[model samples]
Target: MATSISPLEVADCEVLHAIEQQAHSHPWSLPTIQSCFGGLYHNIGLYEANEIVGFAIVQQVIDEATLMDICVSPACQGKGYGKQLLKQVLEQAQHRGVKIMMLEVRASNQAAIALYLKLGFTETYRREGYYPTESGREDAIMMELTLT
Candidate 1:
């Protein structure tokens, strides 16, 4: 029974950071995560009952939405939390009149790449050496989804 919580809550940071460290080998720093407040950033958490299960961080500029980060606790992966988080973002987009959704992912992350593709996102470009990896660097696959 995952639940959703406000990312702006101070206490929620610890839970978010914990899940982030558990989910990403190179997770975004707590400060970097905080910097997402766009003065209007839309970051959401997935919870069950009262436990934080996953999260999605995103921002918008006019009619476009750029997904900055996302993660689901390893223990809860494959439980639809990721999809739910993404759906929330899309709903936010629709509410804000966003026409396109965009994001970049490490080329090596086949599972996430497949998920994005399955969600109707199309590869539009790639940014080489966009992420640091055990193998040095990885390309960032740019993907976009049209809202209407």
Candidate 2:
């Protein structure tokens, strides 16, 4: 199916939240997802036939942006939707004058790490035991992409 990227609307939160829950073992609360709708946050949704299949949330500060959260519905995973959403986020950040984009992924998320690396992001740091896991906690790998 052809997918298009667009700004996430308030009405889209419920579906996005549902997708998030299915996409992650520890999903953001609905309130947390709703909070990204305003302020310095940029939320974009990947729509297939007007239904959200993936989304990315980013926050900008000065010349830098943080990719706060990104996910593609489990049913829609591995079909390049994640990459497309990420590219849209990067383009939007660059258009907003952001010079760098940063994100943290669970150290065990090799798929995500590979994708980030494929998109020119380099490992910048690591936060030990930064994310909760079934076995207690997991490290977070911080990655950065210089856009300017």
Candidate 3:
């Protein structure tokens, strides 16, 4: 399996959105994904055999970066690809002089929460009824990692 991580361009938005739809229950719209290009955003793609398997979107503002989104193809999940992608993103952010990384995850997503914890992120707080759910709204756990 030939795998590589590279910076992603706006041209890859369709692919990113497709993977997002596959991996998330309520994925971001294509327009939303496309709008992340340029400026403060730094996106990366995880490819295997020259095909995209996962991706992460991060936005930096001075010393802080927010992990806006990350998703691995459902077909490629549970094989450590998500962790690999996140690790690469974190490294890149730190190299770019970012002092802190932050992200929000659905409170119901135990797998993602565990992954974040393994990556050294601590729960800072929670926003009640932050994300919409089938039944109603769900809380969003805010996690942060101090890279310095």
Model 1, 1-148: lDDT tens per residue?
Answer: 6367545454477777888899997988888776776545678888777787888877888888899888899999987778878888888778889899999999988989988998899999999998999769989999999997
Candidate 3: tens digits of C-alpha lDDT, residues 1-148: 6689999999999999999999998999999999999989999999998999999999999999999999999999988998999999999998999999999999999999999999999999999999999999999999999997
Worst ten in a row by lDDT for model 2 = 32-41
The TM-score leader among the candidates is: 3
Ranking by lDDT: 3, 2, 1
Clashing residue pairs in candidate 2, if any? none
Tens-digit lDDT track of model 2 for 37-96: 777889999998888899999989999999999999998999999999999999889899
With candidate 1 superimposed using the best TM-score fit, by how many Å does residue 143's alpha carbon deviate from the native? 0.6
Clashes of each: 5, 0, 0
TM-score of model 2 relative to the true fold? Answer: 0.97
Stretches of candidate 1 above 4 Å error? 2-11
Give candidate 3's whole-model lDDT. 0.95
Candidate 3's C-alpha runs over 4 A off are none
Q: Candidate 2: lDDT of 66?
A: 97
What do the candidate models score in CA lDDT, each in turn? Answer: 0.83, 0.93, 0.95
User: Sorted on TM-score, highest at the top, how do the candidates line up?
Assistant: 3, 2, 1
For every model shown, what is its TM-score relative to the native structure? 0.91, 0.97, 0.98
Single out the weakest 10-residue window by summed lDDT for candidate 1: 2-11
